[model samples]
Target: MRAGRLRGTLGSADRPASALGFRRVLAVFGALVLLVGAIAAFALTDQVWLGVLLGAAFVAACVNVYWVSRRLQHERPNR
Candidate 1:
């Protein structure tokens, strides 16, 4: 361990950082927020079952967004 040296057992150098497009990230964030709000509203109204459904929807949205983002990343090349 040294202050000026990178620390890692695996050999990796100059690997590009991973990230999703900003607008896509924002869209997913908005959808998640809406889903949370819906779940909260349903729970507040004592509609627990509906809230559960919304929760499931939120999970589905998250998975779909992740899959789509991966696809987009693989579909293009970095400049």
Candidate 2:
């Protein structure tokens, strides 16, 4: 064992590609969930306005998540 060194194995490393892939997967899953939720809400409650509001919220959330992930991916690395 030594300072700044792992005792048994390499700890971790940056993997922007993996992070991007994960985001893509998440985005797809979230879109599917949004679709299902909207359909269920409509069928169960007959509330068109509620469905519209939820859809708008989902889009906003997706946009924010995408922007933040892109910003993080392009961020300057510490020297």
Candidate 3:
């Protein structure tokens, strides 16, 4: 209803504004670009099935990266 207020009935905010830092966001964007490139390469060569496989692999890699990042972040000393 107001300019900066939401209509949802929520309790409170308990999380940071952003979940990922700039570098992590950039890394994700870079990974997405590489995945698109791989898919495009396979599509151009008429290997759609391989492109699907590559897409799956890309997802796995992204998940792994996220896991590692979280672990490392947890181990990092706070500023």
Candidate 4:
């Protein structure tokens, strides 16, 4: 167990995640927020087609957020 932990730490020493993953996470969060706003605007305007479109985009952004989170988690060290 110690050896495994050591290896994990060593492998991640030079590939720190703080800066590298932050931008992607921030971007995904921003997109998600924008999608939510668009969804609300479309709903309020009574534009069914645009609302549906925005909903789809919102869903896609949600999935992307999940994927990016998972990827970043994997990139980080266990410790």
Give the best candidate by lDDT: 4
Error of 3 at 7 (Å): 50
- Model 4, 1-79: lDDT tens digits are 4543434343376433355377667768777776877778776787787777777777877777787777667766462
**Candidate 2 clashing pairs, residues 3+ apart or interchain:** none
Models 1 onward score TM values of 0.53, 0.49, 0.50, 0.59
Best by TM-score: 4
lDDT of 3 by residue, 2-68 (tens): 5775434332363223444555676677678769967786868787777777788778768866975
Model 3: which ten-residue window has the lowest total lDDT?
Answer: 8-17
lDDT for every model? 0.66, 0.65, 0.65, 0.68
The regions of model 2 sitting more than 4 angstroms off are 1-18, 58-79
Q: Report the Cα RMSD per candidate.
A: 10.6, 6.7, 11.2, 5.1
Better of 2 and 4 by TM-score: 4
What TM-score would candidate 1 get against the native?
0.53
Task: Tell me the tens digit of each residue's lDDT in model 1 across 1-79.
Answer: 6575644432245333334566468659866886977768686878777777777777877777887677656744442
Per-residue lDDT, model 1, residue 56, is: 76
The model with the greater TM-score, 3 or 4, is 4
Q: Model 3, stretches more than 4 Å misplaced?
A: 1-37, 77-79
Off by over 4 Å in 4: 1-20
Model 2 TM-score on a 0 to 1 scale: 0.49
Compare candidates 1 and 2 on lDDT and give the better one. Answer: 1
lDDT of 1 at 72: 59
